[model samples]
Target chain A: MLTLAQAQTIMTTALAHAQSAGFKPLTIAILDARGAQKLFTAQDGTSLKRGEIAIGKAHGAVAMGIGSRALHKMALERPYFVEAATHAVGGSLVPVPGGVLIRDAAGTLLGAIGVSGDTSDNDEAAALAGITAAGLVGDTGA
Target chain B: MLTLAQAQTIMTTALAHAQSAGFKPLTIAILDARGAQKLFTAQDGTSLKRGEIAIGKAHGAVAMGIGSRALHKMALERPYFVEAATHAVGGSLVPVPGGVLIRDAAGTLLGAIGVSGDTSDNDEAAALAGITAAGLVGDTGA
Candidate 1:
């Protein structure tokens, strides 16, 4: 189980990296292995629905047990399957690079984190940085 | 009925109020009179589901044509009716104090704002303050 402290560390590090890189205002969501939201943040200037997108990215990663980067590829090669999965998950799946699954050193699934606001690649980099800063491995499914 | 600028004003003011009052991290949602989302923000470290709760509060207010405080009383006094209404609104109704209806000086409904993070009363207070700061009237259905 990912503790709140760990979740906070991930969020803090992610935001710090985004700020240092001068990315756009970001929204981040962290979900535990059970797919429940653990922590969320939306920067002051984020546009509407960024929060939902962040959550969807994280939620979909957890629901499908794969990083969203993998889901994005699946979405390309198997569009129908991805669409069905999106519906099955109540339309919360956003196949993109920003969502990454989190695992501990022993390869135990911890949770997932989703970031939005910057380019998808930049968002994914931020997620990876956060997970690494927390001493967890990030599975981008790449 | 509300512009994005107005929505941002409400959000900024609401967050300012929450901070000055030393309330917990908050999540806020602003919805137009047509029930479309206008803006949303979740402070860093907000708990899971707060975003939904905030949206539900505002969405329910806009859908029912009343503030969520009134909805709370309705939920208590006519539980079945409120339950049916909740279902009718696609299960977005959250009868609580933090949901408020926004109106112009001419008493035209412009939108609704929902807040979550602190006690219900404090949440409501923050909502009202935000609306007032935006130069709008807030109907809490009190």
Candidate 2:
């Protein structure tokens, strides 16, 4: 089981990366297998909107069982499904930046991480660092 | 400016109280003034279903500038406005347990918290813990 400590480490590392990269402050979230929040953080200067975007990305990854990039592509191909999910989930299905699937070395689905700060690419990179630092594998979908 | 630390601490204390009270596992969310995420947590056994409820409550509190309990009452008295907000926010309006406004000592708007667990009352109690822990005032709608 992924402990809250591990999730916090990922969030901390991700935020550190964002700071080192000179990106805007960010918000990060990690969710466990059952879509429960394990850890979440928002940096000092991060816009309030970034927090929701981060959660949406993380929530989207956990709900769809895939990295947000894949979900994003899926949304492009099947806008209707995305729309339906949006209505069904009631605003938790955000298919945007800073979300990725987290897995163990043996390929078990553990959870997900999301980050929001600079551009989507930068945010993705920061999230990937956190996953790697925590010794977790992330499905980047690219 | 509500720091993330304050938000997380509030949520942590709230969850602890909920667990001590033997309530069901929960999904809880907090949002700052700009409607961005401040903190989010899902207890060990909380189902994904709770996520929607929690988010809806938080969103409703922010959108209506009132506690969700008040919104629930208003919904009964003015169904049209509630229904319209439900549609306007892309289906994120929830006027039930687990939502409340966060205010400063002077009653300035700071943020909102939403929770989903046991009953609306239980959820409200948890939200109250979070708000109080953060040194923010809250109206439980009771």
Q: What is the DockQ of each candidate?
A: 0.13, 0.40
Please give me the total number of clashing residue pairs in predicted model 1: 0
The 0-to-1 C-alpha lDDT of every candidate, in the order given, reads 0.88, 0.81
Backbone collision count in every prediction? 0, 1
Write one digit per residue (lDDT tens) for candidate 2, span A22-99.
988788888887776776777778764776688788888888777888778878999999879867776787776569
On the 0 to 100 scale, the lDDT of residue B1 in model 1 is 72
Error of 1 at B105 (Å): 14
Q: Any residue pairs clashing in model 1, and if so which? A: none
True contacts kept of 1: 0.02
Candidate 1 per-residue lDDT over residues B8-107, each given as its tens digit: 7888799899999999988888888877666666666677778789989999999999999999999889999999999988999899999999999999
Model 2 over residues B1-142: C-alpha lDDT tens digits? 6677778777888888898898887888887877777777666666657777887898788887888998888789999988998898779879875798888899788888888877998989988987788778886554
Q: What TM-score, to 2 decimal places, does chain A of model 1 have?
A: 0.98
